[model samples]
Target: MPHASATARTNQMRALMGGAFLPSFLGLAATRVWLQVNLFASYTQSDDGLFTVVNNLAYGLVMVIGAAIALRKPFSKGNRTTVAWLGFAVMTFSTVLILAGKETGAVDILAVASVCAGIGGALGGGMWTAAYVRLGLRQSVLYGFLSLALGSLGGLALSFLPEALSYTVSMFMPAIALLCYQRAMKTDVGPQPAPEPIYDKEPRSTMLFIFGGLAVFGLALGISRGFPAGEPVPMDALQRVVHQMGVVVISLFIIWWFIVKRKRLSFSFLWRIEIMLVAAGMLILSVFPGHFTGLAIATVNIADTLMLGVLWITLQDVARHTTTDVYAVYGFAWASRVLSRDAGRVLIMVLGAMGASSYAVTAVIGIVVFALAASMALLLSDGILKLRPLFTEDVAAPARRSAAGAARETRRAEMEGAGASTPAPAAMPSAQAQPDPQEWFRDAFDLSERETEVALLIAQGRSKSYIAEALCLSENTVRTHAKNVYTKLDVHSKQELIDLLQNRE
Candidate 1:
């Protein structure tokens, strides 16, 4: 019976993880299929600049409006589910419209579907992003990476299927994801209210600056991603699949190594890498044009998708401070993302329409913009860190604390051997003897699971590098978390934090 019970418990754990991942998987799948089939492949034989631009613009506009409305309205599980369901239905219809348009060469049908899919995607993406955040940062980032990888694979698989069948399946996929999401929400705990709203008093200039910078970065990447309008190359479908698969495999290993294992780059460094990849990718596409363009484009797409995950994680960190509906903050961010991507697509289409000379001009412009975006990344990363630090406590926090505890015991033993007694730690007035300052600090500040670990290490006189090593995070991330801990405890530095915890004892 015990053996059976253990097996049952393991199964439940697996189910919980899978359920947590459903929304991101489906939301990403929806967009991936739409882009691959409608934008990339459909336009291979003809000038799809108009269709692509309209579709992206319509998509962006809907998100902006929907996000604004969601801000004013209160969030509830039922409301989010309802929106997901409606989106599933509408987007499914749009998929069908796209299929018909492809078969009959009707540009009008495709255009209308763009508007419909745009609205549907905004509803679904906004809700799903909020849900992803509720899962915590590590799980959310892992799931996003998996989602993009699987979604890309899924898009490739769909390309093999007949148009009608693939379209039908694509339509159903989002609905299935929403169903899973509804089920997950049933078992999920709701978020706690933040002590203060971060965005409520944010300056208008700050908002504009941040969103505008993101738009510029997005535009540069967007235009670079699109292929110049031309005759279809004799590239084999098998070769393209191989290129994409290779990218996916390489990306997975890189993500696991840097993020999951080493925690090498801070959020700031990661964005810099992303921008550099975009710049390099565009240059390769422009220089190499027809030959090996598939490989270059695949590389760019993978980097772009990875960056999207980073962007979301950053936004969640920022939004965590909001006292209002957290989804509203995410909604606004998503709107910015949509607007940036669409604006790039529109700009590229306009440039492509001019002449072949404009193609070189586009490449030159992309290279220039990429340089500018790279510079902006450094500046903006610092700003984002100040607003909400990305590096702090992570998945390994508990293990790090255990190691610290063990080290403390070893040191105490060494002291005893030297004939020195380790005195009892500081205690509060009017309080009984307390053991773990960690728990005391946690309860006093109402810190989250992650923050509590950080505070305990800080109180123990751990350095930023030490805390980062223990927590399996980059030093910059540790600093960010320390800043957040100080803010929450209403203290300014590690000494003050330690003092506060001792006082609360």
Candidate 2:
């Protein structure tokens, strides 16, 4: 009876293991078959229609499997670390599948399916990683990072091949990883901490990330453009030191923004913008990279401006989404960008007969892609509308409340001030007539009251010109008073004056 009990337990454990690997194995098979079919005509040029048809059916089936598996996450262990481990496993397993495909036979897959699978897997893994991180599973960070490293390696390595081949080569790594992520993708995966609302006040981290990213980027431009190409752009010793320092400053700023401020570039916005810009950059860069002839250079120039601006805005979004739910969205964006760029190669192959026009067509295509991306950006800005309230109701709440309180106080003070003045006793009281403290100041300063008034005006946040108009003084006269006021106030600059008033100290 004891032996039978042990035997039954062993069989039960064995049965339980089936569901674990079953989905992943199916996913891998689906990816392989689907990819093989999609690329069948384009790469292998095989004449068999039956194989192609069978592969297509297999590809669809794989997605169904993926969808099912993706939905199976049970939300257990409940930490980002667990998520990280699971995500890493999924990623590694997918990569192994990819390796298996390469070893067994990659030529049999459909190109489009391959790209889709690869993209799906990357996203799946990223999604799981974020779930873990957001849940505060720091211990699992190593695993998440490992998945990223391996996934990146696979992406880059696979990129070297023909588009279809690369897609086929790349598809499984994430799928395999997804296998391991079953427990992490649950609805209850993270801490489920509600998003904090934010309002008018800019996030310190966001501003920091933006300025820092821009500064670093700007420094790069300064370095690359500040000097002549062949001449080494003559910043001898001292200048070089300054330039180097500038780069350091920019780099430091970026680090502060990305890490310290924890201001993230949102994933959705980045993807929307990055897809088109990356395509544009590749197109433009393809023309001559560093140098180009008239039309070519002209063609690529749009990309340069767009790339910088896109990077400037999207960095914030990317930083934040990289850790939250649907984290794989970032991977999806990257995969889209990668596919869009690489898929362009297909056009080259199709139009190979046109020779120079082929390249020209590519240039034209780059422009079109850029325009499409711009349009997409416009569309995505609307996406922000949907997310805005969330980002607001959640992230901006405190700041908005604080501002509201301040505004209310200001209104209260103004009401009190108005009530304090009995207009019945004072007709111009609305205009203020207390010794025209304005006039007393004029007499005391050995200057016109208007000048004193201007000094007071400068103290208030009014610009120099506003003060001139208010005092009925010429601009030059106002300037003179400003200088005198500065001297009397023992302030070196207007900024000092403003700072003094603004600071309670």
Candidate 3:
């Protein structure tokens, strides 16, 4: 039984890894290498940050437009697929233009490429966001973290490849991402109708708090990137590799904390960490100027990577629980981040062009850092940070029920001891009298027959081994079914399942 259980876990991990690869590959192929090495280098001749500003502006606008359209007229499955293919084609053509411009030194070609890349990338991003929404919370987090880790590794590997080879490989990333999307379409089920209320009582406030926080963070990131400190030091291949490694390390730790340890990670906790990292990085940049620039950059990258993972998870959670169009939610959230970052970058550039003194630049950094800290504090004080339902699992419900159950038991015992004529407890309801909870949940969540059986045994307090023996299935198969049941029911454990059933009764 133990061996089978281990095997089942291993297989599950493999499946998640497989699912994560395409997204990670797509990310690798789409932006990091191409943007940094090709476009940025080429455009630096005209203006160091012009390409980035244009790229980000175009990207943000596309996301906003796409989201607005989706809100007004949600795309059918056929339309979504068609749009995604179009996006893939556009992105590929953009890459070709970039290469052509690089070879021929045509600034116009690169400018057009930047716009194409941004539009194409936004379309592709929406498609991926929809795919993630279908995975729910836990699966989405796992897949998200794994994808980040894999993308980091891919980036690290590309650092070793010759520039020509790397650029060549990058051109094919959109096609690979599309292939992965197709694979997901075949293997995964469509989004099920939510049984509970989809609309929140005060969704606008919740969204403002969440997306507003992201905007501040993004602005800080942009300031850090654009800060003038003796001409920004371009990260060498070694530095790039180290940066990627740091991302990988951080991604693994988050996966362990969120998935393996199953800890409750509040958004407040995430914000606190990010604020500190950004503040520290900015302080370092201000004090040292030219020295330790890599260290400062590394801190910013780590903070951004962490924020991005949680942000994606939070977006998915909101989309799942709310009536707001999922595409709009994702699009607006992304735009908020991107556009704000662009604002910060542009702010710094304007200041630099104005011949701002070092002291003034330092002052600006301090103000941005202060704004971030102040915003985070406001969020915490407003109870917005405590909005776990928008990000983390609400395990407190089960804990509260457990405590209430104990109190009821104690009250019943006291009543009996007092010799009062308490009414006899009603007889347990039969399957005919009340629908079997396992069967009901099965129908509601669209759980398979095997999952229904597993849930029933689990609620009865049967061990996995015992259930496996009774059902004549491998422990691994039983374990898989149990997991599916838990995910479908949105419960964390067997005890929660039991509490849920009792409540239903």
Candidate 4:
């Protein structure tokens, strides 16, 4: 096992949170945000020999150390989620500290938060993301705000601002956001899958945030595109290639989540190939290299703006469906970022060592080929997807036949028991005789009238939030009870949950 990670740090953070005096999660959060900026500067400043080499070396050392510490925490205490957030926080803090000219103790502070707030932010983000999508955007508005506020404040304070302000932004803001999301998820479900299904509507707050965020990203990307770097054909080709690569990375991160992630989670095709078509169109424009007018570039930019929206919505929805941790998602995002970044660094070092522009072009070609491979993989999977039902049938037939046999066996035992030829042991019901989930919950588990009410709600397909509201309890408490109910009832997945709720036997 890797010895150097954020394990010891996370345990320390968890311990520090005792008796309501929550540890300064913001300070930790600040560290991570700053780390990104520093790591970026380190890898990106290829023009500055001294800065680039030193920064890259720093980047490598920190990541190795952080990972080492991250991997060594206690079972409950050694949580990856917390350590990541805290690590990011530390990264942010250290970056800000160094940038702000107060480099003292930046590494140590980061070492600690790399443990706690990291997990909270990572896990909590996922929980909140799901809550937002399912509960409605308006419902989770406060949660988003709190998170943004936390991030922004920590960012500012750790670098430009000061620690006092950073503490409030990082610790209090995020904690509030998490609590709000937890509350919303709890009361969103009803008592049972009432004969009528409970439907959810998106809140206006989410729409506002989504639009606002896109606008900001657009404005930033536009600014970064750089002014007429010259009409020289070479420069044009370079920009086209780089720009295309950037978008490809975005697709690599976002598109597969919609396509492959959905299928992995037993969801049907969630995104349209039309989306991939746009990428195809861009690739053609890039490879052909006819100088596109600024107007054409502007048009594509707008399309990309829209494309980004599509990506964001896809991500939000995926978060909703999969109940994935937002921070963990971010952490995964972190992994992509770090790997890409480090690869970029290693490549540059090798290129400089060998003296070649050929490596850069080779890298671009490799990216294009990988993108093509990804497309083919999607096509092949879609084909296999079509044959899934046939496979389902192959398994279902034999299972049904066996179920019939068991039913016959049980029927025979019942008749013999009724005749009283002898006092026989109670006949065990066949698998097919299993009751529907709700019925099973009501009878086999002997749940109370109220307990049964809650079980029925869950079985009927009500969400936790709706259940909490109907039961008039906080979401956390509701989850606790739900956990107990699930455990006592001997079920794990929600499908099983529903089957039991309905007494499907």
Candidate 5:
């Protein structure tokens, strides 16, 4: 029995290593490596490096297109696998063509290749994220962040190699991503298919947070990258690499200490810290003028890394909680991120072209952008707070409650068998009392009495907390009941629940 148990654990570990870790490593490594190699290509292709903007824009556009396609596809295993394989071919071919174009100075080929690669990345990334999400939020977030860290290190190493060698190596990443994706899909330990059908609506509050937070993150990263460099700091390439490595290390430590180890910090708290760090880095850069050097760059790098990790983590959390269509949810989120990033890049590129290249001008504009992003983040936080119940509902609390309820019932049975006296039966309630509007809905849908009570409150425009208070039930219980009500009635949102009841006549 012990050997069998150990064997099971070994299989689980292997699945995680192959499934979640490898694909993530390849995907992020490919992205960063592509950017780096393209930059090198740009140096030789054009004196002004304007083609970098085109490359980034191409990637962003394809990501958006792929997300739109994801929305149109039904969430099925077969479709996801097809998308992954197709993405693999496109990305691999594009990587090869772009490198070949760079070597031969074929500008048009590079541009076309960039667009095709972008499309492949979008399709592949969505499918990959879908597989990861099935592993649940914590595993997905952990592996995802680890992948980025490893990828960055790998990209940095590849940056030093000969251009041809670097490009050749990168061409293999999509194939690795495909393998990892397949492994993830074949895992036996992942989340089971949800029994309740997924029918989520884009709540205004949720959308506000997702779009706003991503915009803030993307814009900050874009401006930092595209804003014409100030007087070069007194640092060499090696020093810069070290700084980046250090920042990634520190960021990983912070995430581990707060989230994985201690597990005391809430998502809201961690998010606020991320914003503050980023804003602080920007402020330092602005105040110091050309003096913002190695430390400043490191600070910004750390903040950016944190923001990316947090954004993806939150996105996966949102997908996990809201629907079973993980691919669609993550794809939409990825599209928003890409669009926002490109928007910021375009703005900065235009400003640079228009002679706003001075350090002072860049700093001032950056500060303003950062301030606006901060405000949007605040609004997102408030929105999420107001909708906490909905956000927490889909994290599989129902299964936990079911197990707990069974335990409680078992304890009661044991007590009764041990001669514990039951309370005297209460007098029968009068049947002549006014009929509950709740009863009509309950009978129509075969709802439990508790569910019927929650449904009536929902129909009457009562919040989850209010229903909990009135019924003297815990909030988790209230949410569970409400979820059952929705599943049984085949409704998505509160409005739908009300509509079904009201239109019955």
Candidate 6:
């Protein structure tokens, strides 16, 4: 049994690392490397700040528009695949145009390339979100960390390549990502099928809170990126590489903390860490100005990377637990992030245009940073940012109620067995005469062995925590099985399940 469990786990990990993993890592690396090489890195040297700003604006707007379309009318799987491919093609072409424009000093050509890149990036983001929403929470977090690490490495590698070569290599990355995404969708590593979307009891409030928090983080990151004098200071090659390596180190530490130490790392914890890192970076940048600029930038970059991982995992969690259209949820979340980021950048630009003094600019940035931190604290205080656990303790009340009902049934049976004179109620039949509902439901639903065990316990009025303890499984794993059972049995709630098992009219 141990060997089999180990083998299954190994297989699951392999599946996650292979097909399910590549798209995110490759897509992120490719986008970052491309933008850094062609836009940001060359901005000061080539004096193309306008191009950089235009690209970001276009990217943010197109992403929101694409998300809106997706929310309104999600594409079929085939259509989505096709759109992803189209995006890859556009990105490739845009890369070529960027290369040509750089060689010829054609601002118009670069502008066109920027717009194309935005459209391509938006499409690719939607596709990746769809793929990520399918993974379990642990799987999402693990992959999110590892991919961010690997993606940072990939970007670092590409940053070293000659400009043309880098562009040439990056052009193929989106296509490869699309192919990997297709593979992930086709592959099934577990006995159960992909989980179905469940009805969200409070999607509106939940989404609003999640999106609002992310927007604050995004704006903070954007403002930090645009520090000093509105225009972003691009890191040189060595600084850029070192910054990415720092991200890799952070990712490794998180992986160790979560997996090796077996700690429960929550989203709220990550949120706090991000806020602290951003605050520290903003402080350094504001105080020192010219000195330690690289350090301040690196600090913010690391924070952004961590926040990105958190964002991916949080979005996936929301999608799994909510009945909101997965595409719509992803679309809205990403849109809010991108738009807020642009808004932050524009705010910085406005300050720069107003000819604000260094002190005034620093004061404004500090104010924004404080607001961001305070807003997040408010969210945490209000319990708005608290994620729903995979298995909630709310089930305990239902289990207790069901246990009392069982006890009453048992007492009634005893009275009948004792030959009591008073007649028992007609509605409450003896459970013994009923077909074993556990086995009946198990067989009818074609449940697996583990699922059968879980179902039996649930039918016996066991709370999720009790079942987890009894079965020696994590509550999250148990929830997965429970969800599978609920989905297969066509039931929505524990009480409904108990009533069905009791053969109640």
Q: Which stretches of candidate 1 lie over 4 Å from their true place?
A: 1-49, 189-205, 227-239, 254-259, 262-265, 358-383, 394-437, 440-505
Candidate 6 — which pairs collide? none
Cα error of candidate 5 at position 293, Å: 5.1
User: Positional deviation of 182 in candidate 6, in angstroms?
Assistant: 1.9
Sorted by lDDT (best first), the order is 3, 6, 1, 5, 4, 2
lDDT of 4 by residue, 1-505 (tens): 2443365444333222211212222222233233323432211111122232344344434433443443343113224334434434443444344433424555554434333333333333333333444422211222232333343333333333343343434434334443443454454331111111101233435333333333333222222122122111122333333333443444343333422231121111312332243344345434544454332343333334234224333344333333234333223323332333334334444544555465554554354345334433432232222212100100113344346556656767866878845533454444335543434455567765456656665653456776675566788877877777788789997668754443444
Best by lDDT: 3
Q: Model 6, poorest ten-residue lDDT window?
A: 390-399
**Candidate 3, residues 343-438: lDDT per residue as tens digits?**
887887888778879688768878687768765754543256233234433121334434544655665685688775664345322422464454
Weakest lDDT window of 10 consecutive positions for candidate 4: 387-396
What candidate 3 gets wrong by more than 4 Å, as runs, is 1-48, 189-199, 229-232, 378-388, 392-505
Give the better candidate number (2 or 5) by TM-score: 5
Instruction: For candidate 1, give the lDDT of residue 67.
Output: 62
Looking at model 5, residue 10 earns an lDDT score of 62
Q: Find the number of clashing residue pairs for candidate 6.
A: 0
TM-score of 3: 0.72
Tens digit per residue, CA lDDT, model 6, 114-167: 778766766665676666666655456676777778777876777677867877
lDDT of 4 at 193: 17
TM-score result, candidate 1: 0.69
Decide which is better by TM-score, 4 or 6.
Answer: 6
| Location of the lowest summed lDDT over 10 successive residues in candidate 2 | 226-235
1-505, model 1: which lDDT tens digit per residue?
A: 9997786566434333422334433455455555555544522222244565566576677766766666788667677767777867776777788888878989788878767766666665555665655554444555666666766677667767776776677767666667656655554532222223435566667666667666766666566556554322232465457535644664566457544453433666766667667666666766877676665555555555666566766676566555656566666666676577666665555655665476566765655466456547533464553343453333233554465467567656766876765543443212234434555566567787667777776765556776776676898887777778888889877667755764563
Against the hidden true structure, what lDDT does model 4 obtain?
0.37
Higher TM-score: candidate 1 or 4? 1
Best by TM-score: 3
Q: Which stretches of candidate 6 lie over 4 Å from their true place?
A: 1-48, 192-199, 378-382, 385-387, 390-505
lDDT of 1 at 238: 57
State the local distance difference test value for candidate 1: 0.59
